[model samples]
Target: MTLPRYAYLGPAGTFTEAALRVMAPEGTAEHLPMVDVPSALGAVRSGEADYAVVAIENSVEGGVTATLDTLAEGEPLVILGEVVLSISFELVARPGTRIEDVARVSAHSHGLNQCRRWIAENLPGALQVPASSNAAAAVALADGSAEFDAALAPPGIGESLGLEVLVSGVSDRASSMTRFVRIGRPGELPEPTGADKTTLVVHLPSDRSGALLQMLEQFSARGVNLSRIESRPRGDRPGEYSFSMDAMGHVAEARVAEALIGLKRTCPVVLFLGSYPAFHGEVTPVEPETTDESFAEATAWVAALRDGRA
Candidate 1:
């Protein structure tokens, strides 16, 4: 009977809030709006919320470094699921203000990047002022605390907050989308959906030339395809780096499990973020040699050979 609590980057009308709505809907869960992504995730880590929804990647900006770095360290949270939302922005300003009157625009860093070309072509003279979030920028404008004249905010935020929409559909790429994940304290993983993704953070055993290749081969040899991969500076040393990757299969699958085992033996640090349902729901095609049956048969064969049964 108690509603689940969800902490997200928000002041109400943010893309993260929208993603949370997609997962929990209005009145279904308690929404706790944090000032930023780290705070949102921190709320979950502190047991202040049941889950946290934050953006991990954007089509235009690629990986969201804040989310990646935060998830890579800390108390260890697992992704429960993901939501990918098509991104679109609205140029909003005070009711009496016009586009030409805007001298400055405020938006989150990623928002600014996605709308960079549009902003350049349309608001050529406007200076970009980065805010913690698009919704925060809108909130600042609405509350008369903003130094910027306009904000690049999610669609509908202008109307909801009593701002004027100077221009709609503001984005360099029409197909731009951001991927958000629902994160929670590590616990029982979701049942393996055929269409799933397993996320991980791996630190190479050494800085040697072949170390990276060896780490990647664990998945490659097991027929586990990687959907996304990025290297982040380990920060402990200048030459060291860690990889954050999304492998295109559930950890429950044989190929994925074997690949993880190989990484455990080779990599110095292998962090299993989680195995969750892919937002797109596209099932990864498994090769015949990598099927669960094949793995079982191979194991049996190895056991038979050990027992001299051939």
Candidate 2:
């Protein structure tokens, strides 16, 4: 039997690949590293791979617009799981190179932005070049064709690529972390753990003043705890946007299901992204009044009343 294949943002030493490795483990699957987040998802969408792992958000940089936009506009895909990794950067250079020997420094845009203060304070006069990824910067240096003398990347990139670390612990914030999601073709949903989260996008009916407030009331009134909410343009018009939110329960939960039903009636579009296990291990507190049995009883009561059985 052939082992399953997984795709991830790559050139091998990327943080996305590291997160995927932890989820899939070595020898469990054939991990293929794609050049970008879209390509990783494309591999799975095209049936070339079983799943793709891509960065969804970062602690220091907010949402990864590339991944967010892709998930919203591209072919339908469902998130299967998520992984959160603590992040750090190292300034690595080619053999025999020192900080003084460097004329330019390179990193991915986010990498450079996260370490902005460090680079400005240390390199002083070096040019800042943006690579597709930090690992790509390492590849360029290894290829001996890069004009840059050093790269700010995950420490593992340097060790794996045989580069020397010129400076360590370089991120501006030590507590920085990133969240990555595993996506696959829409299929069987993951069995809901007590601790789970459901993600969705809500496109409002209009841009009226109280529209957003009204939409939020659906969750608040239902006591649904929203862990995250972000707005993005609806792509076809001006002054209109869609809200992406993550709530603290699975769709199977009565409270969450009711809230979504309310959102669908109130919004022009309600895209169900996925409901997966929360990586944080934080479970939603179950309420006695909103248990599955209670919801079923209430649903039956309404049905009987409509049939003239008060």
Among all candidates shown, the one with the greatest TM-score: 1
lDDT per residue as tens, model 1, 1-310: 9999999998888999999999998889999999888999899999999999999999988999999999998899999999999999999998999998989999999999998899899889789999999999998999999999999999999889999999999999889999999999999999998999999999999888899899999999999999999999988779688999999999999999999999999998999999999999988899999999999999999999999999
lDDT of each: 0.94, 0.87
Q: What TM-score do all the candidates reach, one by one? A: 0.98, 0.94
| Candidate 1 TM-score, C-alpha based | 0.98
Q: Pick the candidate with the highest lDDT.
A: 1
What pairs collide in candidate 2? none
Query: What TM-score does model 2 achieve against the real structure?
Result: 0.94
Clashing pairs in 1: none
